[model samples]
Target: MTTPAPTALQRPDGSPLRILVVDDEQMLTDLLSMALKMEGWEVRSAASGFEALSLAREFEPDAMVLDIMMPDLDGMSVLQRLRQSGDDVPVLFLTAKDSVGDRVAGLTAGGDDYVTKPFSLEEVVARLRGLMRRAGTATAGGADPVLRVGDLTLNEDSHEIERGGTSIELTATEFELLRYLMRNQRRVVSKAQILDRVWNYDFGGRSSVVELYISYLRKKIDAGREPLIHTVRGVGYMIKAPQ
Candidate 1:
C-alpha cells in the first residue's frame, strides 16, 4: 500500500522497485520481504493465489514472483487469470521441481522464467532484476535496454536471448549475469565484481556459489556452443564470443 519515493532517475542500489511475492510459505515470504526491503524495493506478499489476485489489483506491482504449488488457487491459474485480465506484468515462477519439462511448462504457461527452490537470496534478487529488465520495466517509459556481443542479442524488454537465429531460454539469474557480462564484453570481470553487481553482496567473498551458477549458465548459454562466458583463471569471469 506504500508507494516508493518519486525520483527523476532510478537509483542503482536504492531504486524503488515495486515487487509482489506470492508464496504459501509464511517463513519464506517473510524472509523474502526482508531481503527485498534491504535492497530498496517495495514488496507486498500474499500467501495464496486468491490473495495474490486481490493484491495484484491493489498494489499493481512492476513485477511479480510466484510459487508454482499452492493451496486452492495454484500459481499457473493465478497467472492465467492475470493474463486474462490483460495484465502483462512480468512473472517469475518458483518451484521445487527443476525438471526440464517443468521449466518448459512454466514458460508455456506464460511465465517469463522459473527459479527452482533451494535458491539463494542473491539468485532470487538477480532473477527478479532480469524479469523486470525483460519486461521493459527496468527503465522509465517501460523501454528495454539492448545488450549485445557481436551477433548475440539480449532483449531485456522481451525476455528474449538469441545468437545468430537461434533463441535460448535462460533462467532469471543467468539472464542478469549474461546481461552484465555482455555490457562489459571482452573484459575480464572478477568474481567479486560479478557478485557485487549481479548478486548485490559484499560479504564472505569466498563462496563457490558464483562458480556453481556459472556452470549452470554454461550449460544453458554456452555448453556445446561457442562459449560466451569464459573463466579468467584465478580471477573471475568474462563473456566474449569465441574469436
Candidate 2:
C-alpha cells in the first residue's frame, strides 16, 4: 500500500511543496523523484552537483535531497556555495559514509539533515516531511515574522538576519540554531535539546557539535559586539540582550 501524504507537505498557498533531489547516480535520482512525486509534491532531479546548483536557483525548491559523493563538485561544495549566495533552503545529505565525522561535516557545511545510503524510502520521506514542517515554521506568515534580541534581528520569512544594522549571512543550520536560541532567550538550553531540535540527531554525550556551531554563530553574530551567547557553565547555553 502507498503511504499517504503528510498534511505538512502542502504549502501555505495550498500548493504542493517543491523538492530537488540531487545524486550522481541516475537510478537513485529517478527513484527519489518517483517516491516524492507519490506524496503529491513537485519533484525535480539533477544527476550532478552543477545541475543541482543551477536548478536550485531557477526552481527555488522548498527542500533538497543531496548526495554527498559526487564527482567534480560534491554535495558539501554545492551546499556551501548555496549558503554563500544566501540561499537558506533546507538540505538533507545522502551518503554511504555514516561516520560521526561525516554527519558533523554535512551539518557544519549547512545541511539540515543526513541520511545514510541503503536507507529506507519511508525514512527519507519522513525526514523530508519533518524538514518541510520546520522550514514552514521559520517562514510562517504572522503578525511578526522577525525575532529580536538586543540589536540582533532575524526575519523568518526572508531568511535574513541583521545585527546592529549590519547584515549577517548564515547557513541553514546556523540560522536554525540562532532562531532556537533567540526563541528561548534568557533561558538556558541544553546541548541535548540543541542536537535534537537543530541537528535532528541524538548524538548523546557527543555534544561537541553544538559547541562548534555555537562558535560559528558567535563569530558572525557576536564578534566585535557585546556578547549575546553565553555558556551557563556546567549547564548549557543562553542568549540574551546586552544589559
Candidate 3:
C-alpha cells in the first residue's frame, strides 16, 4: 500500500529552502548535504568559519546547520560574526558538545537550536522544518508525507526511497532532483527550470550542471532498472511511470 501523503499545504512558491551546512569533517558535510537535499532543501557546504560567513552573504540561506567544533573558529564564533553583521538567519548548531553549558553558550551565541552529533536524519529534518515554520519561511503547516512517481517512493519524513518494493540509495543531489521531478510528475521540467529550482542562485552559470547530475541520477535510478526519469527531445525532462 502507498504511504499516506501529508496534508496539502500552500505550494512553496516553487522554491527550495536555501540552507547552509558547515562542518569541518568532509564525511559529515556530505551526509548532511544528502540528508537535507532529500528533504528538498537547497544546500551548500563549508569547512571553515570564514567560508561559512562568506556563504551566509552569498547564499543567504534561510537557515544554517553549524558544527560547533572547527579549526581557527568555532560555531559560536561564526554565529557571533553573523549576528554582529546583522544576519539574524535562524541557526541550528550540530556538534559533539551536548553539555548544558554548551547548549546555553550556543543559544546565547544566537543559535536557534542545538543538536548533538550522531543525530537521526529524521530529527534534523524535523528541527529544520520546525525552524522554517517558526520563521514563517516555509508553508506554515505540514507537507506531503511522501512524494512518489510510478514505483519510486520517497518517504519525506523518513528520507527513505523504494522502487517496486526495493530500497535504493541515492546521493544528495540525486535525491533532490528525484523529489523535484516526483513533485512535478508528468510535467515537462526544463534544465533551466531544474537548475533554478534545485541549485538555487549558484547555478554557477553552468548550463550542463543539470545534465551532469541527471546522468548521475540515471546511473543509479535507471541503469539496469526501469526508466522513471526521461528526456524530452529539444525540450527538457520529465518523470513518468512506464506506460
Candidate 4:
C-alpha cells in the first residue's frame, strides 16, 4: 500500500487540514477528536448522522471518519445522501462487522477505506492520511511531491510511477504500497508497521498481503534491473537505491 505523506499535508491555501469525525458515541467522538487534533489538524466531530451532514456541508472537510451504524440516518445512508448532493469528500468507514461482504459493501457504498470497530486511533490517522494523499492536497511548503529511489520515480499529483524513463501502470492498491515503501525508503519496516500504514489494519488474520504486494512491487520495480526492493529474512522489507 502506498503510504501517505511522510510530512504533514495541508490545504492549498496553507491552512490546517480539516477533518470531520462522525460517530454516535460521545466518548468515542471525543477520543477521535483528541487524536486528530494532536496531528495539528482542525477537527469537528458530529454525534449523529444529521449533525454529520450539517457539519459536512458547513465544515467542508478534506476527509472524514464515519461510523457505519448510527442512531438516526446510519453511516451508509449519510454517505448516499452526500453522494447524491455531490459531496465527494473522501471517507474512511468505521464498522463493527468484520465480514468480508460487509467491508465490501462499505467500499461499494463509496468509502475510500474502512476500519473495524475496536480500532486503534493510529489506524484511523493512517487511513485518513492515505485517503487525503490520493484526494489531492498541498504540502506545507508545496515542494514538488515526487519520490525517487535509484532510477524509479513516483509522482503524487499524476499518480504515476516510472523507472529508467519508462512509465509503469499500477493498480490503486499497488501504487499505495509502493508509495509507502518509497516514503520510508531504506528503512526496514516490519510487516506490522506496513499493515498499519498501508492496509489500515493491525496484525491478525491478515499479513500475507504484505508479502504479496512486496512481490508485486518487485516485479514492476526491481524486475530485470538492479534490485531495489529486498526482503530481509525473518525481519520485514525495505526498498533502497541500487548499491
Provide the clash count, candidate 1: 1
List ranges where model 2 is wrong by over 4 Å: 1-5, 137-199, 202-243
TM-score, cand. 2: 0.58
Candidate 3 clash pair list: 6-145
lDDT of 4 by residue, 1-243 (tens): 343355667887888999999988889989999998988899999988999999999999999899989888899999999999999999999979877677778888888888888989987887787788777753535667788888899987788899999999998889988888888888888887787667654547577988898888888887899998989888889888866
lDDT of 1 by residue, 49-87 (tens): 999999999998888989999998999999999999999
**Per-residue CA lDDT of candidate 2, range 61-159, in tens?**
999999999997999999999999999999999999967788888988899998887987877887887687776722232346678888888876688
**Model 4 TM-score (2 dp):** 0.77
TM-score of each: 0.59, 0.58, 0.55, 0.77
Pairs that collide, model 4: 1-176, 1-177, 2-176, 2-177, 3-180
Global Cα lDDT for candidate 1: 0.77
Q: Pick the candidate with the highest TM-score.
A: 4
lDDT of 1 at 117: 87
